[model samples]
Target: MLDLARERQGGVSDYRIAQLLGLKPNQISMYRHTAVKPSNPVAIRLAELCDLDPATVVAWVNIERATTPEDRLAWEIILKRLAPQKRLKQAA
Candidate 1:
């Protein structure tokens, strides 16, 4: 997610992204390092900053955070249904 943000539309620094997301720079760094997952609102805003679909991004994040098989499956289904066709094609 941060990768996308950094690579898109010229580019953005972690500090700039933090400012845009109303978070601290260390939080963005932690999220980039996989030491922490952004909360849903942060994830959505990050996706928006990256020119991504918030619903798809949130669904993907939920899948990664899911604890049970059923929970994961539900999020996967939602992601599959909500993600753009171009993104689905890229994944395939």
Candidate 2:
């Protein structure tokens, strides 16, 4: 989510994102730095606000939540299953 926000056009500021999430700027900083876990609701809101796939974003959240290598590998496999295509086709 943080990477997506940074890669967005105009590059959304953490302060702006925090304001959008109704959270303190430092909280956003924590999330950015991985000092603490992010709330799923906030992550979903961020994904929606960024016009990203909520399911895909949630999959990423699940990956982040995994504490063990085996668990992370399972989530990675699930994500790969979910995204069998190399890329989404462009609209005509």
Candidate 3:
């Protein structure tokens, strides 16, 4: 999901994607982390916005929905830790 988000080149920030899809920014954030799936309507909107296949988007959402909360939290922590390193590399 982050891959797709990055591919957008900020075309789909959490707030903007949420607003366009009638979801909350937090929901978009969760989607990025695979913490939760969007609603069917929101999934369709996300596919359109991200230029992804709707079926692929739906599959991703379903996979996210199946993840345990603890795993999601752990993954988020790892991402947070790596984020600065990624930025540093980009800056270099």
Candidate 4:
């Protein structure tokens, strides 16, 4: 389970996970913390990176994919707020 992965990885930052999966950091955080689940493609990537079962990831992904755009946007805002300060250090 992703919750377990979050725990096992010593509270791995969602941004790092996003980087590994080539997604926006906010998207990773949304998948991790919010009720909105990840998409199948995202689940597959997460399973591959986290050494988790694809089925489990698929279930979560299905739920996340079903979320409304408005809900996802809310999660995006929440995830941004929850992000660490260091993540803003990029030389953009």
Which candidate's TM-score is highest? 1
Query: Using alpha carbons, what is the TM-score of model 4?
Result: 0.50
Each candidate: what lDDT?
A: 0.84, 0.75, 0.64, 0.63
lDDT of 1 by residue, 1-92 (tens): 78788777358687888898999999987887774678899989989989887888898888888889999999998877775775766899
Choose 1 or 4, whichever is better by TM-score. 1
TM-score of each: 0.81, 0.67, 0.50, 0.50
Task: Report model 3's TM-score to 2 decimal places.
Answer: 0.50
Per-prediction CA RMSD (Å): 3.9, 3.1, 10.2, 13.9
TM-score between candidate 2 and the true structure = 0.67
List, residue by residue over 1-92, the lDDT tens digit for candidate 3.
Answer: 54464457465556765676787777767766765667767777767767766655655565455568776566566546656775786799
Worst 10 residues of 1 by lDDT: 80-89
Whole-model alpha-carbon lDDT for candidate 1: 0.84
Ranking of all predicted structures according to lDDT, beginning with the best and ending with the worst: 1, 2, 3, 4
Which RMSD does model 4 reach against the true structure?
13.9
Show where candidate 4 strays beyond 4 Å: 1-3, 6-11, 63-92
Off by over 4 Å in 3: 2-12, 63-92
The total of clashing pairs for model 2 equals 0
Off by over 4 Å in 2: 6-12, 84-92
Candidate 3 achieves a global lDDT of: 0.64
lDDT-superior candidate, 1 or 2 = 1
